[model samples]
Target: MMISLSRACVLTAACTVVLTACGGSTGTGGSATPTSSVDVGKASAVTPLDSATIARAEKQGSVLLYTNADAEQMAPVTKAFEAKYSAIDVRVLNMTDPQTFQRYATETATGVRTADVVMATDAVGMLNFVSKGNVLDYSDPNLKNLPDYARLAPGVVAMSEDPVVAVYNTALIPKDKQPKDLKSLAELSKSIKGKVGTTDITNPMSFGSVSNYTAKHGDAGWKNLEVLGQNSGVESGNGNLMQKLAQGQYQAAYFVAGSVRALIEGEEAAKVLNYTYLTDGTPMLPRAVAVTKKASSPDAAKVFVNFLLSAEGQEAACAGGFTPYRDGVECAYGLPAVEAVVGADNMMLGGYLEGIVKNKPEIVTRWKSAYDR
Candidate 1:
């Protein structure tokens, strides 16, 4: 569930609507990009998406995408998808998760239907759409092929497996000294107080950060995050957080795993960076997509969703450096295998996330006070 940034060009002729969106990408799959052609340091970097299916996807008329994955990386695939489905179009509005959800919720609430498709990091956000009757329900004929976990919503499905990875400047910390788990990350926060980078506590971090928050110190886990923030010495919006980490501005950043890997090997950060998983908060986020409840082209939308979950599309996504959400599309990129298939994939945090809507004032109040500390 990575790689969502894109230029206006990323939005194909399919839709006139413009909105912000975010998703993630890592370990080469249907994408072939180092985002701007900057020389990533590794020769064996993550695989790009499968060239064949991507070639087909580019031709599928115009499909608007709201994701966190890199738009630059998606450009080739977008071009290819449009080419294959000449009648279709593809557009990726690349905005941060917060901005994406904000705009989507705002527009959808006001009866301003702007997006036809969304590939988002927060399944909870998707639930927002579904609950509001903004999302359409149409079980893809291909749903039978997916394991139950992939079929999260009545109509929605997972597109990728993206770990919320923590990255650091390898040059700053020796590999032997790198934190291997969340416990170590907390310790490292103390050990290198000024070197750590964190998401703005007032803003909340990645979905994975939710797990980190709870696992941190119980009901007062958010309080521990404040401590971590103090040690962080730097706070930025989640979207730009990783780019700064890639630039070595900070020793470590908490962001999606696959995106950081591209930066680790794609630029000057390579020689100095390393990433690891937290032993406790281990599961990755799932980026998902679904048709609009008011879809002008329901059939086309279903076709696109089916394409995304297909073996070809899933594998291409995997090759493009992101994990495929469908069953059995494994990669050689060293990502952990899908263990004990999760029963019903759910990424959108439940009622807790309602703060973004229902209790924004209080949520913002608490968040600001935390950062103010």
Candidate 2:
């Protein structure tokens, strides 16, 4: 099961293929020796659908969606889809990225193929499934409406760029005292120690962050990961981690998805938590979604995916607190527009997967060893 977020209103809301040797053992979990560097490929493009797609989708009666996004993050999209179709039922399954991936894999392996769509914050994992032929090759005419970075292979698409940012208790850390970057935050976390929380690196998105950080900053990034791991407690899900943060169990959390919804809930609870992107460069992780290869309702799946990438859907996402992959749609909550914060070249999606998702067993094992110690 996916970990459920406890707080409310928080609306809110990779890549490719190269490897090389770096100076130090790099994979956060593998061997102590320096790891190799990697270059990733961009998402492949799928042929766009004709105008008849939606008409066909209405005949399916329903579409089953499996997603890693919590119920709150998905409510608006589901509501919008159902509202627009008004006829087809959209049944959603909310679970952790790992759980969602595993369920689809298990079902596909057994030929059960229950889910029509799969969505998650783990871009690399979704892409891996795509490579394995688990996700369907889908095209939407709306694809032209999105930035090139949003499409991850012919059938896969990125829905939003939710930054992995710092979340601090405003009441505890004054504005002036807030750390400006991950390194500075690491220094501050040493004082708080167990009071700092973050998702485990084994989660593909976090793992990708580590790999991308190392690729970007080399030894410095690896050192930062060690310092971060040494100073913080590991948590399993964003909702639970943020809940603890709101209650002041942790003074701050590094790498929580900085969605507008989360920030709003902090205010609703009378907590003073605030989120900010890192100064150097924050991991603007994209939540990639696609129709499953075994989709029993392929037509409905395509319609839903297109809706997610459409102007109306993108606007709804922004209103609901998600950073849309579409540019110039306006940002939610007082956050700067995503285009102003990061560029396509800076995304972790296309280039860092070689070390993160491709070598998962070794990377995760190494992460567990380092984390456990």
- Whole-model Cα lDDT of every candidate shown, in order: 0.52, 0.63
**lDDT tens digits, residue span 67-86, model 1:** 66676655645665555467
TM-score of 1: 0.68
Q: Please provide TM-scores, in order, for all candidate models, with all chains considered together.
A: 0.68, 0.80
RMSD of each: 10.7, 11.1
Candidate 2 TM-score, true structure as reference: 0.80
Q: Which candidate is the best by TM-score?
A: 2
- Please tell me which predicted candidate would have the highest lDDT against the true structure: 2
What digit string (tens of lDDT, one per residue) describes model 2 on residues 174-221? 555777578888788778888888887766556656655666776676
- Write down the worst ten-residue block by lDDT for model 2: 14-23
